[model samples]
Target: MGLGLATGMEFYTFDSVNLVLTDLTGTLGVSADEASWILTVYSCALFLGVPISIWMAGHFGYKRFLLGTVVAFAATSIGCSLAPDLDIMLFWRALQGLAAAGLVMWWRASVYLLMPKPQRSPSLMRISTMLYLSSAAGLLASGYITDHANWRLIFLPNLLYAAGALWLIARHFPNQPKPSAERLVSADWPGIVLLAIALIALQVILNRGEIDDWFGSAHLRILGFVGAGALILFIAWQMSAANRTPLLWLELMRDRNVLSSALLGVLTGMILSGSVFVLPEFLRNVASKTYSATQTGQIMCVYALTAAAIRPLMVGFIARVGQRKAIAFALVMLIMSMLIFNRLLTTGTPGWYFALPLVLYAFCLSPLLPAVGSGTVARIDQNKLLDGVSLYMTFRQFGASLGVALLTILISHRETLHSARLFDHVRHDNDVTRTWLSTVSGTLTTHGGYTPLEAQQASVRMLAEQGAHQAAAYAYADAFAFMAVVGIVALCLLPIVPPTPVQKK
Candidate 1:
């Protein structure tokens, strides 16, 4: 329970600030793009911290490491709340991400390490539910806070979550002996440096790619080569014989189950994170009737709530049908949900119209992570479980970064394409365009108390804005279609995932 709360708090802090970015921008006297660095830095730091935490846990003991991270997380939360400017806030946010990485990774790895094989599934389910609820609540809470109170208040709730998690850990968690100096000296410093360079470069590219015009910009072009080269070198260095102490054990990927699970993690992360990013933007900006942040939060909550509700049934379902078949079924459902979004979503669609598809998406997504995680953990050597878990999570984070970057670019390109095509049809020579403009101009003249010349300019401006909105809607629909295609690719990979071992009752 304590572990779950700590994990929940990490996810909540990560997600809650998303809705409050505008508030941060206004208060900190930064541009919207600058404020986004708050999130970008956190994600990058979290990714970098995952394997390091695994290494530290091995030497320092999981109990002591977890407690330290929990304290740091709480302290950083307070720091974030008290930060007077963007630079200070980002510094604290990065530290918070590092603390979160340790807390989340160790807590999850501990579940597998401590639980009996049969009990692992249920335990993971409970933790995942906490994740779902807390993540959903973050959006809701942040939206409300931004609307009614100070944006800094968003970070304060982590304090209470941290306090509860601290009590639970101190009371119930077991203690371990101190670390050996021999093991401490064997750290893979080279591999760590390479990994950091790769992750930092990749994160910068993903976060700033669109703003920098991608490879069109000389800086991004340089970053692209550096990031790609670093990743290649990092992979080679990890697999080489010269490294005595490897940060990440690449040999784990030799197991078919582990490899498949990692791939599944990537696919799930891509779709899940991509949709989370897209939906709110759709509601607030692209839709005909814009929704407030609170309203958008309410709509998104349906997805998390429905997933949490159905998680128990997933354990039984996976047990009965096995992991491969269960994931295959879920992938099909995921594709279906994406198609539904692609087909039904439009500028004029109502919020209620999304409820069914969101529920369906939740059902499809709930079974995936736990099912794949349990299968991977059960198959790996117990001693290497932490390595496997960290690697899998790192892949998922990479996938999330890729998805957001890809979709951002896709939306921008498609919106431009769609707007151009729309404008092409709005010419004076087009009969339909002329009639519509005349109607709107006449209406504005009569109802808005405008002169003829004023009404003509206003009607043209309204027409251009409407065209922009429709183009955005079309672009979002294309994004969903792309997700559906990604889902199909995931479905194709299900065959490679080994069947879950049948546990004797």
Candidate 2:
């Protein structure tokens, strides 16, 4: 039940942003660009705060920490719902991110603490199933609320989940005695500060760079430099620091299996995050006929269902063929999904056309997520497991943010390029352009009883709209092609990851 609440709340918070962002812009009188910071700030705060939270949880017992964070998370969700301006919302969202980081860390921590090492894989599989279900259901539920009720009610699911989480923790988990003040104060404050600077600055640059014209904007250039320098300093400080409470437990990387799994974690994040970001935007804004939020959500639920169905087979396949081979097969499915999209995406493509690729993508996700996560900490020292998991998740979150930003930039640049090239071919002197314009003008004159001048103007406007649609379609196709190539490269890397050693049941 604790796991259920955690899974539900995670999906609710993340999916809430995508499902209602368009409505949010109108309700708050903010541009879409401004609205994007809601998710960006949440992710940035989570990435920077997770390692610190993991370090501190040892001082403050997991049960207390989990309950406090859940309550705080619920409170911030309410605050976000009530926020009247962008600044207020952003402030609340940052706090929400901090609380969410703690909740997720404690969620995994609880799993590790309560169960024996051998029992963990099965437990993880169950938790992964919950995650997939919540992801499938959360978006549809939020979209329904946004359409029929209020956008604010989109967060109601988090409140429900948090209430249940609080009840379960309070009832079942015992609170340990608090550590001494000295123990709390012993954390490496300098390392924490430097790490925060690096993570937050990098996220800000990625989230806002395209809108600000990339490096052309002085602000982004400054952020890029700060992020780079701070990242270098943070790494140096962690490696050489004599502090007993270092920000990251660098020793976790000594285990080759954990290191390889961490890399796989990053790719898994990129795949899932990029899909969540792109599919909704493409359906909502760029489809030949725009789809309603609820419709898009329902379609995406297909991906979730596919994942859930295939999960039972994944563990057996891993056991039979080994983790390395399992991951390789999943990557092939992923590449197939992306290639299908590359060939099929177009303005004229039907809504149903997305189902096949989405299912294949889901097939990739179901196996790889559990495989990488279990393989990552399978051989780690029990005392260092928390740090290892925290670091793994932090990398995954960073990859998620990076993938979304990169794909957004790619589509925007490609759209502009395609639009310009298309324009050159559709000029007034072109015979095809002359014939199309004449046909459109004649139709307008006959049907709408418009004058020649008005008909010609309307005809030109329609042609321009169609051309823009075609350009966007081409851009999306190119983006899909790029992702397919990335998947293939990821598959090629599988040969280097060592297989999990045999274990007795």
Candidate 3:
């Protein structure tokens, strides 16, 4: 189950890192800022989805749930591949998220059910190891697909994989339907809708904020009100009901570890998701690195190597030193890598430059999350574990959305500011500036056969483009710095409390 699921999930993090948005914006001609909603919408869908999915899984048999999820997931990938417009793309993305969350929740429940306590240790290791390798493979493959083939080709392979998986499960895995009495129809629909509304509205505001110049544009302004209203209503709805199926049961908040993990997952996922979103695009497009299939694979391959190498060692370490300590170290590595990222980021920096720190960060991160997750979910009541994992994963999903949106926003904002600053120095103010501009203009005119005057204006536009690239690079650096601080604060805020001096969990 672990191997099958891990292989299926191998591509989970790629959409985040490979930055399908860059292709969507640059190739598909979507607006630069609007493109981020591709990620934002997917994540927000997952934010409120995992819990509902878990309940349905419990109500239905696990095998049935898994099979159904993959079917939906496969179909949606096909739809996403053929989507013609941004709005249509968003709808497919949401469906994909829904299907994905269901698949993952069922896969995890299956793993826990199949493996005994002792076996779970090594089984978990195998799953983690496979996930790292497959994720690296997917990232590299996606990049190559983007470069050589159409982006849609990437999903073709997924469709084949999912179909095969679904077929095997249907044939081999028999489902034993549970008693209807055990599965009550007690879900809180109002809370669910409000939460979804809140998340969707907020995503719209963030993703479109940069392109619309924050609130200066009316879309963002109205979105702000909608997001705020939804959030307020969501809180009221959750608190007002003395219900059995609160979107997130308030009783679960009694556990500190669960609450901490839920919050931490959001931030940690943000850093991971956002970095993956921006860094690769910056490498390939901005720095002009030649990322042929092998080379692009190698960049992610390095990070995977580090994750593979460190995660196993931390497996034992997590058992011994505990999750809180491991999370702290992971945060330190994140900070160190972000510092390296902040200082070394430049338009001229090569692909190989980010290798060492990237590896370390990957290593620290690979095991840190599973460990923290185990600790957090361990706090939940035994019966409510499905709910616990759902909540944990949900926040992590939202964090990814917010992270991408914020990073995109930061890149947009800083580019404008820096470009404005540099334009002053480059404008046609003096002989040197005018000659420099005209020379660039002359080259364009000669190459494309434009008039001398037309080329001059084109040259100015070209200069502005370069200025924006440089500004974006600087902004990327600053964003990494802020991400590092968030890591540090998260690490320190939650102490690795003694585990009641108990034996291994």
Best model number under TM-score: 2
TM-score of each: 0.93, 0.94, 0.87
TM-score of 2: 0.94
Per-model RMSD to reference: 2.4, 2.3, 3.5
TM-score-sorted candidate list, best first: 2, 1, 3
Q: Identify the candidate with maximal lDDT.
A: 1
TM-score of candidate 1 against the unseen true structure: 0.93
lDDT of 1 by residue, 51-150 (tens): 7887787676778888889889989999999999999998998898888889767777888878887788888888888888898888889778877888
With candidate 1 superimposed using the best TM-score fit, by how many Å does residue 263's alpha carbon deviate from the native?
Answer: 1.8
For candidate 3, lDDT tens digit of each residue in 1-505?
Answer: 4236424552544542354456667655777666667777777776666777766665676777777777787788788789888888889988887877776555555555555655665666766776676666567677677678777666766666676676677876656565243322356677778777778778767766655687998878888888789889876666664555566654565688777777787887787677667666666556644345445556756777678676677667777776766677788888888888889888887778889778877966776677666765564555576667666777777787788778877777776787677766775677877888878887888788999878877887877777777877877787777787877877766663335222375
Q: All candidates' lDDT scores? A: 0.82, 0.78, 0.69
For lDDT, candidate 1 versus 2, the one ahead is 1
The stretch of ten residues in a row with the least summed lDDT in candidate 1 is 176-185
* Cand. 3 TM to true fold: 0.87
Off by over 4 Å in 3: 10-13, 16-20, 167-185, 211-226, 239-241, 288-297, 427-462, 496-505
lDDT of 2 by residue, 109-165 (tens): 667867897777677677667777887877789778888888888777888888888
